[model samples]
Target: MENLNIDLLKKIVSTYSPAGNETRICQLIKKEVEPYADEIYTDALGNLIVRKKGTGKKVLLAGHMDQIALMVTYVDDKGFLRFTNIGGISPAVTYSQRVIFENGTIGVIGCEKIDSLKDLTLDKLFIDIGATSKEEAEERVSIGDVCVYYSEVIVDDRHMIAPALDDRIGCYIMIEILKTMKSSKNDIYFVFTVQEEVGTRGAKTAGYAIEPDVAISFDVTATGDTPKARPMAVQLGHGPAVKVKDNSILCHPKVKNLMIDNAKKHSIPYQLEVLEFGGTDSGAIHLTRSGVPSGVLSIPTRYIHSTCEMVSLSDVKQTINLSIKILEEEI
Candidate 1:
């Protein structure tokens, strides 16, 4: 779409914000949303909450800003850094990949001699920062230092391939919605949450604080489009998906139906998502005090949690349209 901001999407996706370390990206989002929001603030767990004042129902919209990463744990005598995963990092997808730390230090992942691919595991892998000794490696990195995949975003006519698209795409959609919104009757709380890759921790706090009438989370969902991939109903370029159920929470029927009805009423293309093994911020938000109803709008994604996660630009645009429709109406 002509209105899609590719630069903004790249900036948000390239920012280094792994789980529990979201300050850099949080600042970027705050600046972008300040003019559009009536009030904005960060919570105890670093969730960036922007509020658009209204007299109607209080609606909370969440999109996590964190990405999966690796944390340095121990350094070997030969100057290699052994680390553990910060989130759901598969050893198969992570082998021999490049990673960048916060201070701009780049490192390459290597693993010990293994019999076969099946023998590959996180414990056998280490990071090499071109250090010759343990002291040298310590000079560049330290224990508990986090790093994310080092990959540049590639955008074409209809698709985007990049790292951290899992939730950054969701953040991008929310920002665009705020920029384009004219007026609304609901008091909308747009929260760019943190630590979702680990356990949806930020949403737990944000949902409790807002205590909204209904909640909706925006995140990426796995697709079945790839060759020999798992048999999922979602696919790229098919528009956004309204969540029915996932591993963590069954979407509240009212919220699910609202999203579906809005898409139909507006003639916006959408698919019904039943994710077999993942969760979104709504997983935690729905369980807030007194049990608030919550649902999710998922962008169909491929190669999730890898260096080159892919999503359809058209699907993203449609997701934004469907989200705007839901927010503009009574929920």
Candidate 2:
């Protein structure tokens, strides 16, 4: 499958771009996408919009660039940095992991572990930077400094594992599709939006700005295939998951059918995704202006919002191919 540019994908995932602090990653994306896009610019809220113009129709494809992380809330007398969540995060999985601050200082997230399962909570977690006093810890990393689980992309057995795969993989898919398309039928807007982990806030503003006739969101959704979790309609390695419905928006049937039919015609592997909780940028885009025909193209993911999320390389490739085909179709 042409190797799918593993080096570029790894680089994007490894770069730290947590919610509200996406300047560096956005700059990297701007450098990579400038030659291929007809126009590219950043909105006031830091959403990077790359456009490819055509006369057929206006279509918006959005994938959030932000990943779930933590914000430092309090520093204790013992020099432990206490943090509250900046987005939806599982404190259980984040415990005892090395984290990098926005300023590049390093620390370890430590939570009080106990034999009883009920004792595990976010309130019990704190970061230790080896400082004996709060003054020392504050000097290294401030009270407002943001932190994300420090992990790098590792490719093994045709799968990529790392933090922030939930949407960074989506970002990679959008950029690759923008790079490889031979011809375009629609005026495509490829947006790498911000603050999705917090509340899909960036998308609401950006969607309003574009007011696209059609919209599609590329992001990762949790797989039910994992052990003892909530039942989900997606599974890892199955293929790209087309959204039927999620917590926020019910996908437009015509758009969903178009995606499914395109996948079938091209013989691309795909599955239906019914997310029991959470949402994608499609949620915000669907309600834009008078309303737009919108749906989602999702990659099945495991350990979402944790330090080590996983996705199949094959699934991501399929997502890119399918998106390109859909954009090229006469609609």
Candidate 3:
């Protein structure tokens, strides 16, 4: 079990699991959770559910398994691959980056000749697989195949960089909580959700199916500490963030307070998040059934949605402690 911590995180980020295609990452997570979970199942929407037996309150913990990706739309006679985004993506960042498909196909994303910077868009982008013609490109890559940023996880000092830390880091937090948790009376359901980048669709389905007493989502939030970044309070290396509000939903007062209290009681570093845009699984989970009180534990991340997403391992460790504290206590 030496170096197991980073190993787990590296595995999560290294796996390919875009919005609708999460089987690969889920398969890796399922193996790790089986030893600690009372029962495990994958729902129709591809959400991986890991249940731990408890007799008191039902607590649902969610972390998405999907990342933003690109889908091949067409292949030209010259062996160029046209694509459309599978989730919210920035065309500004797509130029000159490599992408990998599920079937191990590798291609370099390139852009069409543009007259001006204003004309640069996703439509102007195409992936080149070095094939000589359309027939060769089609043989290796077909329309509808998805690919994510080609990056690997790296750990240096307390910093971790990867392509999909947007939520895989959240998954790592969940896995650690499942392993370190002691005796508790809460019925904990740790669900590795799917298609969050697309629309939080997996969370909506998982929330309806579980309908737990309380829910907490683990996901990454943007940081404003970087030079000339947006005006936001969250910062990398500060601590995990307690969600107050985001674009999609206003966090329930009680659930938000619970997180604040847990962080204080456990002496865990934390921050308050009021993200002006973007949303998490909690945004959808809180609306399921009559309603479910929910909040988010955010890992402050830099350059979110980019190939080199950065996070502090210190903040990540604190997020794990806070999540464990919440799950071990009754609501």
Candidate 4:
């Protein structure tokens, strides 16, 4: 954590910023970007938009700040907590995991009797806060409180494992670019969007308001390097990836090629991504305002959408470099 940017990245990954509850993480972004941004504001949808002004084509770079979590739905008589998942959380990954609410309330996740794995669902899941009875539980937590996966970021020399990297890595790279970007001719909007995990909601509004001529979303994509993983051309430690296609949008050829060329020109290691499922902010951004050409630079990630997501530090560094290269040049 010697790198100031890396240290900020670790904190962003560890912070709880579940969908619809991104205020805390958004504040962190605001403080970090204020020094370098020409203008900054939060939109009606809670997207944090920062501006670096210039006199060329507008560029939008979005990274969602939301993560999957659970909400307290019902308090059972025996002091157990019945909850509904906020975003796409796998039951397999939630079992026995510690989840924390905004007020620092911690609970251990557990599940009801399941005859088989197919019987598994959010309805069968519960959270235990060690309350003696329903009354005590109500005193501690009430319906409508959200809880995020509770885990500390673990860092090795080359990799980081933690929750919320799905898009915190995006936030990190955007902040680094803002901090260290060279003089640029194109106007840039850095948006830390909300509610992307639930849907690309924030990006849609921000995109229309900014109406960028071109956009590049910073997000993570799956890698197939793990044991028996799905076959993907991208892999962790291979460097950042330029998006070709994903479930949401096909990257614009002109933008994608420019990213590829920038990486090659600068000697930044990179890969091409073809994700069959899952979408990022670019999915919505490209469709805004008469179709802005869009692309994505993804940090190769493993165990995505799970509590213990993993990413390569080298890939992240390369992404920052490549983004600066692309943003500084006239487009």
lDDT of each residue in 1-331, candidate 3, tens digit only: 1233887788889999999999999999999889999999999999999999889989999999999999999999899999999888898888899999888989998888899989999999999989999999989899999999997677997899999998999998899899988877989899999999989999999999999999999999998898999899998888899999998789999999999998899888899999999999999999999999999999999988899999998898888778778777876
Best prediction by lDDT: 1
TM-score of every candidate relative to the true structure: 0.99, 0.97, 0.98, 0.98
* Candidate 4 Cα deviation (angstroms), residue 22: 0.6
Per-residue lDDT of candidate 4, residues 1-331 (tens digit): 1244667878899887899989999998899889999999999999999999999999999999999989999998989999888778898889889999898989999888888989888788899998989999999999999999998898988889999999899999999899889789999999999999888999999999999999999999999888889889999999899999999999999999999999899998999999999999999999987999999999999998888899989888888888889988998
Q: Which residue runs of candidate 4 sit more than 4 Å off their true CA positions?
A: 1-4
Residue 286 of model 1: what lDDT?
93
Off by over 4 Å in 3: 1-4
Off by over 4 Å in 2: 113-115
Report the lDDT tens digits of candidate 2 across residue range 32-128.
Answer: 9999989999999999999999897889999989888888999999999889898887767888888998778888988776777678888888998
Model 2, CA-based lDDT: 0.89
Give residue 281's lDDT in candidate 1 (0 to 100). Answer: 94
Better of 1 and 2 by lDDT: 1
| Top candidate by TM-score | 1
Backbone clash pairs for candidate 3 read: none
Question: For candidate 1, what is the TM-score?
Answer: 0.99
RMSD of each: 0.8, 1.3, 1.4, 1.4
| Candidate 1, lDDT over the whole model | 0.94
lDDT on C-alpha atoms for all candidate structures: 0.94, 0.89, 0.91, 0.91
